[model samples]
Target chain A: AQSVTQPDIHITVSEGASLELRCNYSYGATPYLFWYVQSPGQGLQLLLKYFSGDTLVQGIKGFEAEFKRSQSSFNLRKPSVHWSDAAEYFCAVAADNDMRFGAGTRLTVKP
Target chain B: EAGVAQSPRYKIIEKRQSVAFWCNPISGHATLYWYQQILGQGPKLLIQFQNNGVVDDSQLPKDRFSAERLKGVDSTLKIQPAKLEDSAVYLCASSLEPSPYNEQFFGPGTRLTVL
Candidate 1:
């Protein structure tokens, strides 16, 4: 069973500030990783995914995540976050066809 | 392309009552999934269907929960006697295949309140 851990329960950043949300997973082998965002009253939307190839995966809304095998971490990053980036972000890991999600990190953008 | 569709955006019911949610996946998707998301938590998968066949229902509470996909296209999830703990958002998602790499499109979700 694979599990995802998002240490940050909430993150606050100013508009146009750099942001990073840490995500760590516990898996024996290389597992499929993903980042998803959910706005208020909206469903979760896929941000990016890492299966086998690239270490750094780019996603929509000017966000990206880097998969570090040695650290068992896949942290999401954004150079300059916008006001619209305020939402809940979830990290998920899948292995043996079963997927698990983290508790999620809530992002708050300050004006 | 149109995203996944779920009916009754919101519902309110008392404990021990029954509630059912309807979902219609994308036109060409072969995999449909139902997930429960409690307040302040991430979405947890309840059941997964692969073209009308049950692929996974391990996390679903079988005692009072039941789900079915009659035609492999549309699905319905029912709770015989809903509990207060069952209050949450039920989300429907679909993907082109059953693989994890396949991107899933999600529906707006149905918010259920059990008082």
Candidate 2:
């Protein structure tokens, strides 16, 4: 079975600082990777996804992720974080016609 | 375009009771999915429907959970004799197709609390 791993459980970053959320997946073949953000009491919204070409994929809200096949990782990065970026981030892998999500990483932006 | 719609923003029920949630996907979407999201955890896929047929339901607890998407537009997920562990937010999402490449739009979700 395919699975996604988010090493960080919680992260606190100062406002306007750089942010990087690590994600790794275990799969045999080429994987479809995705990043989603969920605010409190709300459903998840897609941040970005990597399907094929272009090792780096840019998504909504100035977010971007780099798909590194060698390490089986797709880490989300943002140059400067904002207060509104504080939310739970989920890394997911899609395979076998199904998608599996990681435990999730909670991001907190401090001013 | 309108996103997915889920009914009963909140529900409270006793353990071993029955509960149901309704979801209306975006018009013309061919794929619909149901997910269970526990507090502090990511959403877990419970079932997936393509049109009016079941496509993937491997994680759904068939013994206590049932879901139907008749007419291929709206869906209903029912839980009989709900347990305390079933307390979580039930999310509904839809995509243009069943392929992994399609982006899924999610609803606000129905929060279920079992006492």
Candidate 3:
């Protein structure tokens, strides 16, 4: 079974600071990776995904993730963080008909 | 186009009570999924349906949880005699296909608080 790991449980950064959330996966072959954000009491929204080409993938809300095959990691990055960007971020990997997710990382932006 | 739609934004019930959640996926989507998201955790897949047929439901606790997608459209998940541990958000998502390249659109989710 494939699984995802998010090392950071909670990350706090000042407004306008850069942000990077780490995600690692355990799988035999190349797996589909996705980054999703969820606001309080809201559903998970797709931020970006990595399927194949282009190690660096861009997504909505000024988010981007880089896929490193050797490291088995897909890390989400943002040059600058906004207060509204604060939310719970999830990293997921798909295998067969099921998708496995990490524990999730909570992002907090301060003023 | 309308995104996935789920009913009853929130629900409160006591232990051993029954609860049902409804979901309407994006039109023409062939794959629908039900996920359980506990607080401080990521969404865990409960079941998956492809065009009204069960694809994978290995994680669903069949003893208490049941879900169905009829006519390849709307889906409904029900919990009989819910337990305190069942308190969480039920999320419904739909995708054009089962592949990763296709984005999965999610509904706002139905929050269940089992007391």
The 10 consecutive residues of candidate 3 chain A with the worst lDDT sum are A94-103
All candidates' TM-scores? 0.98, 0.98, 0.97
Question: Would you list the clashing residue pairs of candidate 2?
Answer: none
Ranking according to DockQ, highest score first: 1, 2, 3
Q: Roughly what TM-score does model 3 have, to 2 decimal places?
A: 0.97
- lDDT rank order: 2, 1, 3
Local lDDT at B36 for model 2: 97
User: What's the residue-level lDDT of B19 in candidate 1?
Assistant: 98
lDDT of 1 at B115: 98
Once model 1 is optimally superposed onto the true structure by TM-score, how far is the C-alpha of residue B33 displaced, in angstroms? 0.3
Error of 2 at B76 (Å): 0.6
Q: Write the per-residue lDDT of candidate 2 for residues B30-77, one digit (tens) a residue.
A: 999999999877789999999999998999999999999989999999
User: How many clashes in each structure?
Assistant: 0, 0, 0
Across A1-111, the per-residue lDDT of candidate 1 in tens digits comes to 788999999999999999999999999999999999999989999999998787999999899999999999999999999999999999999988788899999999999
Best by DockQ: 1
